[model samples]
Target: MPATYNTDGAEDPDLYAQLMTERYGPLRLILAERNRPAPPRQARANLTPDPRAAEHRHQLLEALNNRPQPDPEPAA
Candidate 1:
């Protein structure tokens, strides 16, 4: 919650400005810029596949999907 006035009980302009700014700053920006243009995203076309990443992904998938390799053949 936020305070409506300062400790002195008077309509402190600074306090009012702060509270208003905190509560309405984001909204003011949104309303002021209806179009709200967003930054363009760059394509990762040049990024190369990481062999280690692929290997780790494969290991993780196998760990999740495969059962404990059945205890090796009984010692007998």
Candidate 2:
């Protein structure tokens, strides 16, 4: 974006005015002079849990309750 002011130390209102006029045109300007707030963010819930989800949760709870185990032996 260009600097909002000119080098001569004047606010470049004319540049933005021209840009808005060209981009939106005068009719749109007359209809709505201001912007509206953006739509709210939407969140979707997980519809179905995985079949193995319960088993995985149980395993996690058991691991948390028990003493820390050594790393498993690497595969051959």
Candidate 3:
């Protein structure tokens, strides 16, 4: 269970800010230019597949096929 603080009807601004900072972290302000637009992306005309893809697949299949099997459990 987490500990909680009771304000006990106290409405002090500094106390509220202190409790808030303790419960959360210090307040942060981020200033950004929302009106700015993002840069355009480049479009590729031709895309070529990797040449060694088939070789990698063959090696992975061979490793899986060559893997040792676990011994079967003895009859209970």
For 24-69, candidate 3 gives per-residue lDDT tens digits of 6544421123335668867875478879999999999999999999
RMSD of 1: 12.1
Clashing pairs in 2: none
Q: Model 1, 1-76: lDDT tens per residue?
A: 2333233553777676677668667545645576677789786675777769988999999988886666678677
lDDT rank order: 1, 2, 3
Q: Which stretches of candidate 1 lie over 4 Å from their true place?
A: 1-34, 39-46, 66-76
lDDT of each: 0.66, 0.65, 0.65
| Predicted structure 1, TM vs. truth | 0.29
Q: Where's the lowest-lDDT run of ten residues in candidate 3?
A: 26-35
Would you list the clashing residue pairs of candidate 1? none
TM-score of each: 0.29, 0.30, 0.34
The ten-residue window of minimal lDDT in model 1 covers 1-10
Candidate 2 lDDT by residue in tens digits, 18-63: 7666766764444454455567875777787799999999999998
Model 2 ranges with Cα > 4 A deviation:
1-43, 68-76
